[model samples]
Target: MPHPATVVPEIASHLKRLLDFVDPLPGDVCLDVARGRGPLPALLAPHVRSLTAVDAARDGRAFRTGPVRMPGDALTAAPAAPHARADETGHPTVRADATALPYPDGSFSLVTARFALHAPDDPHDVLRELLRVRRPGGRLIMADLVRGNLAATSRDRIERLRDPDHPGIPTIARLTEMVTAAGGAIRRLDVFTVERPAEPWLADAPDPDAADRVREELLDEVDGGPPTGAKPRIIGGELWFTQTWAHVLC
Candidate 1:
């Protein structure tokens, strides 16, 4: 796909890392759980044979695709929600919660969830449910923010302010333990960092006032105040912070 607008600067690279880690098979049928208003399905469409997206949202936010471009586009994104395409080229969608997926046992060759685990209240249950639909020998891959270099409590405070539903991101050890407890064995775990500008990042906040509070909290941390654990800094006169992401391919 050709990307023209540089909407989300980190998107292209984020997709590249996910694609490499997923190593999608041309013949593999994929199931992406928690299709939260992200560009992932659009970006991964070219690599897989068939894909289905399942999200908890009934509003068309589930349909928003990513901006089209290669890595050089630097996180260019598709247009805003309710106006974007309903998914890449007719990939099907199922509206369902993660804890109780409607698929039969062993139904998919590849199951994935990205940047999604932190939103669920019962992440362990969610992981187990995802595994239930996987065919024997099928791979279950997950990518989510984990407890990283920042002070976790402060980081979570800023996160929750932006999206009240956000549960705290899990620590690396806790994340792996959840997967194992959910009947998945460790295959590979990759950890990396991604930098995001505070303004654009907070722009997605459901409430403007909450977004302001989040900004204030981050700013407070930067000005020698108690750390918010976001480790906020000024770059190009824009506030930026880094997040630790863990990709687990089980």
Candidate 2:
């Protein structure tokens, strides 16, 4: 079995902010794109009528009492409550790619992609797909890292070194443009920064040497101007860096 993830303060705060931005309605049928381990699904289930969480990989483990199942092309074929007897949460997990959702167009009342935008091979295509799945006038929300111009280029380089699957983080302006191009009008936008500890953040890096190099670069910026544009600082004897997050609604 996979170990339970510890919810760090930074992540918790961000999730809270995202929830606030989304303000899910009780009648809304929501879809969480790239929802790994189902944090967003758990939080959203109470507010939304039904929640479907999708990820690229098919994991055997259930998340927050929801059954993990292979995604069907037709959402209508799935039972209204797949785990109604076993679990009251009633949300379902589906294995599918974000760039091409399995559900038909206008299937959901609300669609959200949080913290997973940077991992997609084609974020633009994924955003378009997300829009396609939403019903007319339904809300589409996205929350992800926004790169500042000062460190945008270098940040992408360091992130790719840390995670080979990392596509790249775009600026807030870039994200807005993508959303607009995907047939979404801006409803709301909230921008904030989170300070994350360096060690824990780098612990998951696949390449140790690359992690070290990225660490050195971040550390170098601690005393001077931040190199990657994320403000690096020493707080309470821990090396911390900032990442800007944008909660956008369309």
Candidate 3:
């Protein structure tokens, strides 16, 4: 069996394909809000001129590539680590919130929210902030799980059990209304079904002495068992994963 972290690279390969479909322009200055674990930023680093990876949690920010520890910017009130001001490409990462960006109006050519828009206290305020940093004719790309678009009842119920900080992932029609109403024009929208087949992980009881027992326990506490009706009958059976990607131009 392979280590969980060891499987990340291959998973990132698949994630890149999804990201490319949403934002394909090479050499574009991009902002990745809530870039947990840096998979998107790592794959995107080489493809673009520069990548600004931002997150509120310090633990969720950094990514290591070999001996070099590439840490991301932290968005706390009293900043601890100095922000990655700029790299060779002149694109630097900063610690900031989506609802109140730290840049001047129309500062970036491209702004992206991958699985991040679903956590703001106010999604509309976050949308307005995304538009604030984008230049005229620039683009904003958002990827999130669309509400009621789940392929499985279990998945829908699972999301409901998630943190209250999680954003209300509205349907496609609602997303369209929110974006255009906030001065962003909806250019394109894609729905990607993300299916995670049932595995032994779902059936077997967790190991009490496992290295990540605490972590596993936390996950379970937050969302106990499979989603209410989202599970399939057979173990290792096919399941559906659905996420929405919307491209908006400001």
Candidate 4:
């Protein structure tokens, strides 16, 4: 498996793409829901007027470890504070649930959820909560894994095996329905594919047997067999698959 340090740049690149797509205003007060590990919060703090990053997980140690260093930026340590949870850049971190945000209505100019919607049990409810905290005419952006084909059930099953917290990957239509039901007027939607090696992907699997099963199934699928609906293939001696990423703005 690749070291955690090596993964930071890849994550930063992905966040940069999402940020570019959202294009928040300089004066916008942004909220990043499910902001695990403080990378998104750290990257976003320098761009917006203020940032509030929250996650259901209450591990403050992750935040105090310091933010991911951007390309060409020097690495720095996180601030030493107890009651004050702000990092070195002054972006405050909170521990909260996404289904019911604690903030008052119309509290933020921009709200974002990145690679997090799939874990929520009630995605529509979470979207509604995000909408509730956003000001009138404010923007809501979500980026998550999506399955385009109806036959991708096996892919979803494999994902749940890898991460039990992953409820399931949503279909593009379901995503649209949830956003609309939450009072968002679908402004822009973009879908793209990301290919990555399979071993690293399953490195964090909650169940080793399940991970083995997933690996066997994926390998079989890639050996000149049915598509498995996940676009799996072996490229340059590495097992790889394409994951669909959807960016929705409303």
Candidate 5:
């Protein structure tokens, strides 16, 4: 398995793309549902009047990135932490269920959920709640793991396990239904799918021991073994996939 750190570059890139799709307006009240690590909320803080980060697990340490911290409960009225950095102003944390937001109707200008649509329990009701809190003409943007793009077999296996904690991945068509049913207008919906590269990064081979793990865990399946004489020059890669982004007007 690649270290989480090794994947940061790719994850950060995707996050930027997700945010670009949302394109929040200045002074907008933004709600980040299931804002796990606060990356997206922190990005929105400076651009919007205020940003609220919410999650079910509610880990303050994990979400705290320079003044931005995870919340305890959505119902509790708590103050946000001091801005750890200048750009992190007005980003507060809240602990709450995405399915049932604590705010009043039309409380926010935009609502966002990243990689949490796969959470157990149909997100249709939760999405309705998201739309309920948004002001007129507000936006709702979502980015989540998609099924059956690359490595169809692996995707099938993961979906079949049918873990309750991780509901089966939703398709683009199903995602559209949730938004439309919640009364959100579909303004811009685009899909960008790309396969993860098999070739490990240059820094991946930090030491001999680490190199062995990289080869075994990541490269071993390329052709069922190590590359052959000319295969090293063939630019081999992995099968992990990513969904770029999509958005809707609330």
Candidate 6:
């Protein structure tokens, strides 16, 4: 796991931005749908009545310790930690699939899912499930990776190479349509770009050799081999790419 000391500030910024969509009440109960773990408790606990953290993944999925998250298959060996555990965050935690949460309808005043939508076969299934659990007039927010203007086929190709579980990241329009189709309304939308190095991001790939292959492919894109939608570039002689993220508030 990555040391919490160096990464917390950046993670905190990402999460606080997610919280900006609503006027949070102290009495509101919140659910954080995480694929992995991070500093959620330290950041989100103080804002709500109660917070429950859950995920379908049992092992190294992307770590969404708070709101901003790595891709589901991004880091295996370098997840941000210390805040990853519920006990440490002092919140109830459950091991459950996002598409089939055990909670009843209208159970929570708030639901926040980060970096989890792309894993399910149909993201609409997870969205509907999230909407089903949220109370009427309550807040529902989700953050996900948004693919760039490049060829989605190349992007999906490399994402699957790292972890086969990833169903390609969505375009902004497609994502909003999924939300609306699932009976959620988009009250506000926030999009941002995060530029990160390719090395640390791929350090914990499920297959080490696969990581090398992905690196080659991304570099190939940099060398004009193909458009990957990853928008790879070299920064200080290191491979880097910008990931677009969207926070959809309903």
TM-score of 2: 0.79
- Pairs that clash in candidate 4: none
Per-residue lDDT tens digits of candidate 2, residues 1-250? Answer: 1121233445656667778889999999988775354466667878878787775433432111111122222221123344222222333446677787888899999998766566534777878898999999898898777865444587777777777767777877788787888777788888777776666666667677877877777778875745766566776666777767778888
Q: Which candidate would rank higher by lDDT, 3 or 5?
A: 5
Model 4 ranges off by over 4 Å: 1-12, 58-92, 149-151
lDDT of 4: 0.67
Off by over 4 Å in 5: 1-7, 58-92, 147-156, 159-164, 194-221, 224-250
Residue ranges of candidate 2 with Cα displaced over 4 Å: 1-7, 57-92, 149-152, 223-226
Better of 1 and 5 by TM-score: 1
Q: Could you give me the TM-score of model 1 versus the true structure?
A: 0.80
Give one digit per residue, the lDDT tens place, for model 6 in 36-129: 6644434566677777777556565553211334333221122233334443344334667788888889999988887778774467998999
- Better TM-score candidate (3, 4): 4
| Candidate with more favorable, higher lDDT: 1 or 3 | 1
Compose the digit string of candidate 4's lDDT tens values, residues 1-250.
2222223345566667877898877898888876354355556667788777766443332211112334444211223223336545444546677787888899999998766566534778878998999999898887777878564587777777666666777788888887888888789988887776666566556677877777777788777665556677776566666788888888
Clashing pairs in 2: 151-228
Model 6 off-target regions past 4 Å?
A: 1-11, 59-92, 148-152, 223-225
lDDT of each: 0.69, 0.67, 0.50, 0.67, 0.52, 0.68
Candidate 3, superposed: residue stretches over 4 Å from native: 1-10, 57-82, 85-93, 148-157, 197-250
TM-score of each: 0.80, 0.79, 0.63, 0.80, 0.64, 0.78
lDDT of 1 by residue, 1-250 (tens): 1111335555668778888899989988787776453456666667777776665543544211112223332111322223223445333445677888878899889998876566534788888999999989999998778875434577777778777877776777788788889999879989987776666566667788998887777777778888777787777667777777878998
Q: Where's the lowest-lDDT run of ten residues in candidate 1? A: 72-81
- Which scores better on TM-score, 3 or 6? 6
Tell me how candidate 6 scores on lDDT. 0.68
